[model samples]
Target: MSDIIRRDPRAEWIARNRLHPLHAAMQPVQHSWMGPNGVIRKNVHGVGFIGPNGIKRIDRSGAQQGGAAKRTAAVEVQLPLHQVAAPAFYINVVPDMVGGRLSSHDRDLLGLARQLAGSDGAVLAVVFGEHKENAFATAGVDRLLVLDGHEFDGYSPEQRVQGLRAVDNQFNPRHWLLPDSRSGGGELGRRFAASLKERPATRVWQIKGDECIGRAGAGQEDLARPLPRLILAAVECADPVSETRHEVLPLELSTALARSLPRIEDLGAVAVDPAAIPMAEAEFIFSGGNGVKDWALFHQTAASLGATEGASRVAVDDGFMARDRQVGASGTWVTARVYVAVGISGAIQHLQGIGACDKVVAINLDPGCDMIKRADLSVIGESAAILQALIVAVEAYRNGAKRDAA
Candidate 1:
């Protein structure tokens, strides 16, 4: 028995940490279910279990357990007061050029900052472009710093970083927050974090008390922690109620700061198809998976429904779709009102990307697939047959509505 015992390299490390062998070896398993014709099919992780009827069910226990552990650890781990540089929270607010107003997302950030500040700490709102002071003041900001000029007119990542740097130099704020807008705030916050040699939390959709939760780098795992040095938050669509008034502090634009930053000539904006809206902003999405047969029909149906087109990582990897349209952990994160998954068997990474979506509708051949189990509505059938039927139904509905109006 002693001669047959296998030597584990991690045994010494596990013993030193006082961890059980089972705990060290407990890795998440990729679960599969019986598909049509008795074929076994693998779905996303954390969504597979054996049912009493011999059919497999989605088991989210692994994800739930991991999340619970992380949250518990976050709550229990208390950093010393000496480690904290300051108690205040800083927020970067970018103006909405198209809307010609302060982005409401800024208000959400302000709300988060206020919550983090509590009674003792302060919340500072940094603004770019020409905006009325009252706009931010009414959003519960404690203080406002304005940086307005021609250089700051359009979205310039460099100028934003420099402006943020100036504020950091003056205030040395410990906590920084920015809206996770792709074209604006997201880029600014990520660049700012890189400049400071600090890791930034990006696309964060939820904040619980003092803790911030979001996807870790590479979209591998859910990360939750107390306020960090910097955060790029994905502001929810709903408006936050404001209670605190703010004091506006207008600052003169520093010509030296502008000149020091590399000035790149603004070429006219590149024209893109209006239909190809960023997945982040799309309220309705039609996503395709490996099982989709007619790519042309998929695009046509999505266009007909006025929905943004998206794809699974497998489809993108197989060159069936563009990488930008890939919706998964390693790809882009989408927070759509309605997400339609056609032929997609949900993977854990893909599920994480669309976790915040209001409703999910999955159409797959396999009834026991992960997407079918997790989706709000599931249609089990062949992709081509369902795609054509859905298109015809949409067209008929439109025609009927038109006749009724007439």
Candidate 2:
């Protein structure tokens, strides 16, 4: 056998998996152990090889030493910490957190806030009610303010605006940024701006020095103007802060918010059919591919899960799905919150299409496929069997929900 060591995807995956039960046991045995002086002793010479990229990568997984178990490392880089002890000013952001988490649009808005905040200024996130987000540190939040009260809950825009007004009175942020999307940000930002009697720059996508550029005329043209204190930014405003972690310091309103009579009534959410939802707008998508042998089973599984149906380019070309249902570079570029691929091999175009997706779940027979690699979670199994199991699970969950409600 050739002496050149090869990459082990499965081993690397397991090694990186903190939740894996066998992860600790799979660690590589170093050449040197601990000394009597309570210090770690390692081979001073070297323990890894230099690759073609001219970088030294440590492969602790014993593949190089003919051992079945080893850990592979390519100099894992930790993000630098960005801190502000005493903020000179605040950059307020209201994210369109649809499912109580930071969406990609929210991250991009935070990145914009970071750029505006620069060195001395701080990014203050204004959240209303309860949220399940825990990655605000990595998402570039310097300060976090949660207006958690029953009055601010539900579709109470007046109450939310009152909370923002309170934040405005206290922090007096230099600039207020919010996502200009349908997920509450757009309306809330507009309402806040109107309440403050400030003309906010809407549909803003880029920040060029002292000016802002936004798409106008139904996104057919660009409109440039002086930067406003309040801005309703579009997606891709700026690349999200990736090279640094920030302190998410908690903050509260020093004074109680002034209550106002609500004009809009809270009637709660209404359920809609998934099939009517567009691919680009769908939060959860169940997509099928060529590997899917039973088309009926795929459709049934999608319906059981109440997910919008999608298909790979091959499936669309083969007439198994409509052209509008195709997902790829050649088709619709989806940004679904949850994208589940059933039997897709993960073509480059397909990967590019789902690049903005928050979570990807791949179910395929081939473990080494590109889709499996890109997926945050993967299930390697027969498509027909997996679909059947999924349907059963979904039914059980639905029945349980009904019983509890009853």
lDDT winner among the candidates?
2
lDDT of each: 0.67, 0.84
Q: Which stretch of 10 consecutive residues in model 2 shows the poorest summed lDDT?
A: 36-45
lDDT of each residue in 160-227, candidate 2, tens digit only: 88888889999888999999988889999899988999999999988989999998998878899999
TM-score of each: 0.44, 0.81
Model 1 lDDT tens row, 1-406? 4678677777555543413533323433546533211224343223454432245454333444555334224432221121113434444344332234444456556666666666656666676776643555555555556776677766577877888787788776767887777546777778888999998777675677667778666656668887577888765522342333454444443444544555666676785563668887786899999989899999989877878899999999999998999997678877676899998878778886776565799999876566875798998898888888988999999999999999
Residue 195 in candidate 1, Cα distance off native in Å = 1.5
Following a full C-alpha superposition, what root-mean-square deviation does model 1 have from the true structure? 15.6
Record all residue pairs in model 1 with backbone atoms less than 3 Å apart, i.e. clashing: 47-58, 47-59, 48-59
Query: What lDDT would candidate 2 get against the real structure?
Result: 0.84
